[model samples]
Target: MKKIVTLFAALTIITFLSACGGGEENADAEEKKTIRFGATSGPYSDMVTEAIAPLLEEKGYEVTNKEFTDYVQPNKALANGDLDANLFQHKIYLESFAEEHNLDLSEVIIVPTAPMGIYSSEYKDIESVETGSTMGIPNDPTNLARALIILEDEGLVTLKEDVDPLRASLNDIVENPKEIQFVEVEAGQLPRLVDSEDLSMVPGNYALAAEMDLLSALALEDMPDDYRNRVAVKTEDLDAQFAKDIKEVVESEEFEQIIDEKFEGFGKPQWMKEEE
Candidate 1:
C-alpha cells in the first residue's frame, strides 16, 4: 500500500509538471510579437512592403507577408490559421466569402483603393472618342459593373432607371450615346488593350502591374465605400492587439504620405479623406 501511494503521488506530480509546461508554451505563443500578412500581388503587397510592414517592425514586431495570385486563397489561409491577417479584399467581399465558405472573418481597416479608370491609346479624352468605338471592358462580373458605372458617370452611357450600380450589366443600358461597342476580357488583361482598343477600362491594380500611371486615365471612378479594399483578419482577432496595431499604422500620417507619393490616384476612403 505504501509503495502504491508513492507511485500515485509521483504520477500526479508528473501530470502537474506537464500541464505547467503546456501553459508556458501557450503563453509564449500569445506573447510572440509576430504577424503574418497576406495580400494579392501588385500594389496591395507593395503597400505592406513599403509602409505597413516597416511600421510594424519599428514597433518590435517580426512582420512577414505572403503574396497570393488569386483572391480565394488569402481568406482560406487566414481562416486556416496560416495567416494572421490579409489585406486584398473589401468588406463586402470578405463578408460574402466568409458567409459562402462558412468561415468567420472581419475587417480591421479600409485602405485607399485603386479605382477603375478609363484609359485610351487612341482618343485623347472621353469626349473625343468616336461613335461606335469598340471599347474594352472587364469580362468578369465583379468588375463589369464598375466599368459600366464609370461610363454612366462620364455621360457616355445611361443605365435603365433603378438599375443597381453594383449589379449593373450590359443589358441594363437604356441609352448609349457613344454607341460604344463592348469587348469583354479578363480584368487583369484590360491594361494590354490600351494600344489595341478605342478605350479600355482598366482596374487600378492591373494598371499598376502593367506600369500605367493612374492619373493618365481619362477618368477615375468615384469609388463607393463598399468597393474599397480592406485589411481582414479572423473574426475572433478583430479586437486583438495585432488588428489594433494594423489600424493604428494605417491611420498614421506617414501611411498617407506614402500612399500619396507611391500610389497616386487611388481613391481615398471616406475616413482617409476626412483626415486630409
Candidate 2:
C-alpha cells in the first residue's frame, strides 16, 4: 500500500508538470500568430473594423486594427515591423509616401477611393456658388490638386495647362471668375470648417465623419489615372502567406459589398488586379 501511494504521488507530479509544459507551448504558439492592421479613424478603418474584420476573423486570422489619426504613421508602422499591413492610403499616396520616407512597401490590393467632394452649408447647389465666394480646401498636395481639378471640372476655376495634377493649386489657377477667396485648412478639419467657409473641399471619409451624406455632395472627384486607395505590406513580405491572406481579404466579395453598401454609389474607384 505504501509503494502504491508513493507511485501515485510521483505520477501526479509528472502529470502537473506535463500540463504546465503544454500550457506554455500553447502560449508560445499563440504569441507566434498575430496579424496587425493599421488605418486611420475614418470611413475606411470604421468599415474595416465593422465589415472586413469579421470576414478575416472567420478565416482564422487574428485581426488587430491599430488606428492612427495622421496619414504618415500607418505606412511607417507597416514598414518598420510594427504592423503587418496597412489599408488607409491609396496607391498614389503610398508610392509618394514610400519614396519620401525611403520605405520598401508594396501594394497588395487597390481599394476604392472615397470620392472627395465640395460641401457647403450656405449654397443650395454648386451652380448657386457665387463669384468671389470663399472656398476652403485641404493643404495636402495630392488632395489640394484634386480639389482644384474638381473646381475646374465644375467651371468654377481654370488652372494652368502645364500644372501637374498632383501638385496643382490656387497658384495654378489662372482665372477665377469670382476671384474666389481660398482658405487652406487641414484635411480632417475641412468638414467642420464648411459651416463657416462659403464652401469646403472635403475628403469622403471626413465628410462621413462629419455625418454628411455623400449623395449631398455638390461635386465628386473624378477617378484619377491611378488607383489611389490600396492595402500595402512590406515588399519583402509580399509573398508571405500572411500577406496573401490580407490581399485575399481585400479582394474578397465581402469587402466589395461593404464598399458598395456604405458608399452608396458615391465613389466608384477601381481595384488593383489579382496579378498586380
Candidate 3:
C-alpha cells in the first residue's frame, strides 16, 4: 500500500512539472515572436510607441519601433528585411517610392492622415498675399503636386485640365493669377521657412513636427482618398501573421482613441468613419 501511494505521488509531481515546462515553452515562443516596425519621427513614431506597441505587447508580441528622421530610410530598411513593417507614407508616395527604387512593397492598411495646409507667418490669410510672392512647397514630386493642387484650389494657380495630380509639376501650371513664384524646398525644411516665404504649403506631419498649429493654417487641403497615410510591408509578407496582427491593431477602437487624444487636428481614420 505504501509503495503504491509513493508511486502515485511521483506521477502527480511529474505531471505538474511537465505542465509548468509547457507553459514556459509557450511563453518563450511568444517572446521570440517579435515584430519590428519602422516610422518617421514625430507623430508616426509617437502613435506606434504610445498606442500600437502596448496593445501588441498585450497580445504577447514583442514590438520594436525603429524611428527615422527622413522619409527615405524607413522604406529602405523595410525592403532590406531590417524592418517587419513601416507606417509613414501615403499610398501614392509608397507606390512612387517602390517604383522609383524597384522595391517590392505594398500598402498593408491606410491609417489616419494629416491634411496638407498653406501657412503664412507674415500674412493673415490667403487673399492677403501679393502678386509675385514666393511660396515654399515640398520638393518631392508627389507632394509638390499636392501643394500645387492646393494653390489651384485657392485660386492662386490653374493646372492643365488633363494634368495628373499625382505627377503634376510647376510646368503643368497653365495659369498663375497671382504670379506666385513657387520655391521647391525639402519637405522637412518648409516649416522653418514659413516665416520667410510669403506663404508655404506644408504637410500636416511636418507642420506638427515644427510645433505649428494645424488650425492656424490659412487653407487646409481636403486630402484626396489616396493621400491617407498607410502601413507598408514587403509584398511577400502581406500574408504573414504579423502583418495581419498590425492591421487588426490599427483598426481597433483603442487605436482610434489614441488618435483622438493625441492628434486632435489630424484627420480621422477612414475605416472608423466608413458606414458599416
Candidate 4:
C-alpha cells in the first residue's frame, strides 16, 4: 500500500511539472512575435509612434521603434538584423545606399512623402530673385540631382539632355539663366540657411523639422511616383509574416485616415490612391 501511494504521488507531480513547462513554452512563442523597426527622428518616427505602432499592437504584435538621427545608420542597422525594418528613405536613396554598401534591402511599401521645395526668406517668389544671386542646394548626389531638377523646372538652370536626372550634378547644368551661384550645403542645414541664401532647395522632411510650412514653398517638386518614401526590409525578410503584416497595416484604411489627419498638406497617400 505504501509503494502504491508513493508511485501515484510521483505520477501526479510529474504531470503538474509537465503542464507548467508547456505553459512557459507557449508564452515564449507569443513573445517571439515581435518586430523591431528603425526610422529617422522627426516625421518618420512620429508616424510610427502616433499611428503604425498602435495599429500593430491592436493586431497582437509587440512593436519596437528605434530612432536614428542620420540617413546611413538605419539601413546599416537593418542589414545587420539590428532592425527588422526601416522607414526613412525614398526608393532612389535606398537603392543607392544598398548598392554602395552591398546590402540586400527591398522596399515593402511607399508612404506619403513631403515633396521637396525651393524656399526663400529673402525673396517672395522665384521670379523676384535677382540675377547672380546665390542658391543653396543639397550636397548629396541623389538630392543634388533632385535639386538640380527643380532648378531646371523653375527655368533658373538646365541640364544635359542625356544625363540621368537621378545622377545630375552641377557640372550637368547646360544653362544658368539667372547665373545663380550654387552653394552646396548639407540637406538638413538647407532650411536654416534659407534666410542667408537667396533661395534654398529643401527636402520635405527637413522643412517640416524646421517648422516651415509645406505650402510656403516657392516651388514644389512634382515628385516622381517612384520618389515617394518607403518602408524597407532585408530582401530575405520581405516575405516574412511580420513584414507582410507591416505592409498590410501601412496600406490599410486606418493608416490612411491617420495620415490624412496628421500629415494633412505634407503629402498625399500614394499607396492608397494607387489602389483606387
Cα lDDT tens digits for candidate 4, 65-158: 9999988999999999899889999887899899999999999988878889999988888889899988899998988988988888988888
Each candidate's lDDT (Cα)?
Answer: 0.91, 0.80, 0.87, 0.88
Measured by lDDT, the strongest candidate is 1
lDDT of 2 by residue, 1-276 (tens): 999999999999999999999999899657535678888888777766876678778777788898999889888888888998888877687887899999999987666667889889899788898878998899988778889989999899899999988778777889888778999988989998789989999887788888888878888788573636677889998897777777787677777777677757345444433323
Task: Report the C-alpha lDDT of model 3 over 137-169, residue by residue, as the tens digit.
Answer: 999888898898898998989999999987889
lDDT of 3 at 269: 56
Number of the candidate with higher lDDT, 1 or 4:
1
In candidate 4, which residue ranges exceed 4 Å CA deviation? 1-32
Which pairs, if any, clash in model 4?
none
> Model 1, which residues run further than 4 Å from truth?
1-26, 29-32
Question: Can you give the TM-score per candidate against the true fold?
Answer: 0.90, 0.79, 0.81, 0.83
Residues 144-164, candidate 1: write the lDDT tens digits: 999999999999999988988
**Candidate with best TM-score:** 1
Cα TM-score of candidate 3: 0.81
Instruction: Report the Cα lDDT for residue 227, model 4.
Output: 76
Listed per candidate, the RMSD to the true structure in angstroms reads 3.5, 6.6, 5.5, 4.2
